[model samples]
Target: MFHMNRIFRHSHLTPYEADYAQWCAEQGALLREGRLSDLDRENLAEEIESLGRSDKREIESRLKVLLVHLLKLQFQAKQVKEGWRSTVVEQRRRIRKLIKESPSLRSYPMQVLAEEYEYARSDAAGETGLPARVFPENCPYDIDDILDLDFYPQAVGSAGGQSDLA
Candidate 1:
């Protein structure tokens, strides 16, 4: 699970610089691995900052794209992505224990757990190749495997709660 404080802090970085740094890191790895894309171009800091102010879906889309590039680098490095599949199980178990011993996670939504394990919605729901139809309490869903998450553009301009509308 991400510490709320850390997530809050991480979200506050100068958006453009952060995005540019992420791009540089991923692109550098691809270049070293002999797979540099000519289409990739550096964006001005102002543009990236503008992206940060955009809607959540847009932000998530950009983040997901950046994550894919990072995962490619990790795959090239032969680094197994186990945090989701491994740490999530243990964390969930601990949460359960804490709940049984006292009573929590009631105040904490399950979505927080899902995000903590970096679970993509489709994978957590087992719409992908996962064996189960839903994410088990201890099971971790990989966010990297989700390639085409869709977002409804109309939802962006509305101030109403999306879940409520659904």
Candidate 2:
């Protein structure tokens, strides 16, 4: 029932829905020219919100990776490898960089720890061929401990509670 000419003629139709590259160029031009009225305000706002969410998701993903490696290091002591330690260190560095860049995200690591820990536990078990029960049901590492570059998890019951690096 819609007519092509009418749809094309409608001022409500924006390049944002038709050609994204063109829309971005047009948006930039609009901003440069101070033509705020011609800008795609709603889509711009949504894009900004999406960016924040993307950073949070990145944090969650990095936390999951870090926790998974830590779990493997802690529970599968016999299988500890340099690669696992490297991954843990790399993920921690990336996570720290993210938090440093966005100070608002400073508390996000702790907030997401428990949920990401559950996922890490499952992943570690699958990767190491160990029972899920081998990992503590709750995360044993505090946020500080996990973030500490020098802090590696010790086997759960080592004398003096020190990490037994295999």
Candidate 3:
């Protein structure tokens, strides 16, 4: 169970004590969603509390601030998740594309390549036209590959072999 009580105070809450509850709630929700904020939580609470009055002017002003902050929190979560997800997804897509493109790797049987890459045979098949169960042990393949030496600068020829080091 939770508790909330209100008592009028002649002296103002110095900002920190004023909006603790709302800030705590917002932060709890954000953390539950696996997000973080760099701003001062105490200050944010104070600002949010200013939005709680019954007067039209006070309510509107505070409501605007609260809405903006809420939107910011939601947007931050979205952007962070999307940014991280896209990075992983794009890297995976790139690796699959490379396996399909590499001449040496292409020489190997689709099953053999799929096992070595740890990708699903089905995914490999989709990318390389091979069967999903062609690899060792007949275990279902997920067709995902981790970044390996082939993606390194030297292996990719970006460093022009050992000559760049010399």
Candidate 4:
């Protein structure tokens, strides 16, 4: 049970927070019966925004997973495992599905690709046991190449990359 004594916060809980199932039923009835004025507009709007945020998070998370494996595939080619390819394929498919669902977010992946690469670089380095410098400072692959299911760099890692770790 939620504590009502917590000060500075709302002393009262709305139907949405206090009893979600009942609130949903009420809202559904309001919508179905064409009772627009009786609907919880504010909560509905917030729920819509929350769904968009959830989709964005899903795409970005999948992109991060793709980046990590792609970095491994590009920087530590000799150490590549079948599991990495499987992960790459899965993440790409999932990311593409999210973008397809929300066309407005089509450019979102490219916009945040570099930022996601930073996380990938760190994770790849740790996973591959190679220094972060072994990978490019910025994302070397573009959105299209990353998304391409057939794309996999044949060339090996950086020159003198000390591949002993891989």
Candidate 5:
């Protein structure tokens, strides 16, 4: 009986920290019971906001990965095309799907494009083992080009109408 009492007492001290699922259940019960005063309003608000922020972060992260692969396609030799092409297609699909679902986030990717590309530029350089100087200082491919299924950027010297980009 003493041990059970101690366990119950300890859990109450930091119920949210000790077991998050239990805390969530308790919070839900409070809400359902209309016990507004008992609800953990502060943490509840934080968690709700966190969900939105996480989706944006995921988009930004995928943008970076997509940029890196596109750079590899443009600057590196044709040998790696198959692997990089697959990644580019997948990222585009995912990004487009995310924006479609959220609707509110339609413009978010373009807003963060320039900033995220800088990170992607560094990543591409590291992955390709070529000087960063080889790649353009700014993103050569725009969001439309990046997301287009048929767009495959040609190298600067490639024999094409768009030697600069697709």
Candidate 6:
């Protein structure tokens, strides 16, 4: 009985620190019961803010994957594979869905694309066995072009059409 009492007391002191899932359940119950005084307001607010950050990170990661595959298609036209095309399509779909679901994030796509473009460029060069210099120092495709389903960059020097990067 004494050990059980001690355990219960310890859990009440810092429920959020002790067990996150239990903390969430307890917070929900508190909200439902109108026990505002018992809710972990600080931690709850932090978690909610973290959720927004998580969405931003997701957008950035998907953009990077899309850009990398696009670069591969542009620079290695001879080696273009179905898998690369599929990835580019899938990432664009996911990014579009994310923005549609969270309209407040409508402006985030361009910001994330610019921030992640360098990493994507480096990754594309590494994956394609091409010199980093082979790719442009800055992103060649605009955000709209990158997300366009019909957009595929032409290969450098195709029909005398040099890449903007070239």
TM per candidate comes to 0.20, 0.83, 0.18, 0.79, 0.82, 0.84
**Cα miss at 86, model 5 (Å)?**
1.6
- Cα lDDT tens digits for candidate 5, 59-145: 999999999988887788454755677888899899999988888998898999999999999999998889999988999988888
lDDT of 5: 0.79
lDDT of 6 at 109: 81
Tens-place lDDT per residue, model 3, 19-128, is 76754554454445454443346665665665432232322332233222222222233222334334334544454454465544332334343343343333434543
Task: Tell me model 3's lDDT, rounded to 2 decimals.
Answer: 0.35
Model 5 per-residue lDDT at 56: 95
Clash tally, candidates in order: 0, 1, 7, 0, 0, 0
Each model's C-alpha lDDT? 0.35, 0.82, 0.35, 0.78, 0.79, 0.82
Residue pairs with clashing backbones, model 6? none
What's model 2's lDDT at 125? Answer: 90
Q: Under the 3 Å rule for N, CA and C atoms, how many clashes does model 2 have?
A: 1
Please give, for residues 26-72, the per-residue lDDT of candidate 1 as tens digits.
44444455553421445544445555344333334433333322222
Q: Model 5, which residues run further than 4 Å from truth?
A: 1-14, 32-34, 162-166
Which regions of candidate 4 fall more than 4 Å away from where they truly are?
A: 1-14, 155-166
Clashing pairs in 2: 154-163
Sort order, TM-score high to low: 6, 2, 5, 4, 1, 3
> What would the TM-score be for candidate 5 when compared with the true structure?
0.82
Segments of candidate 3 deviating more than 4 angstroms: 1-25, 28-119, 137-145, 149-166
Higher-lDDT candidate of 3 and 5: 5
Candidate 6 — number of clashing residue pairs? 0
Instruction: Name the better of 4 and 5 by lDDT.
Output: 5
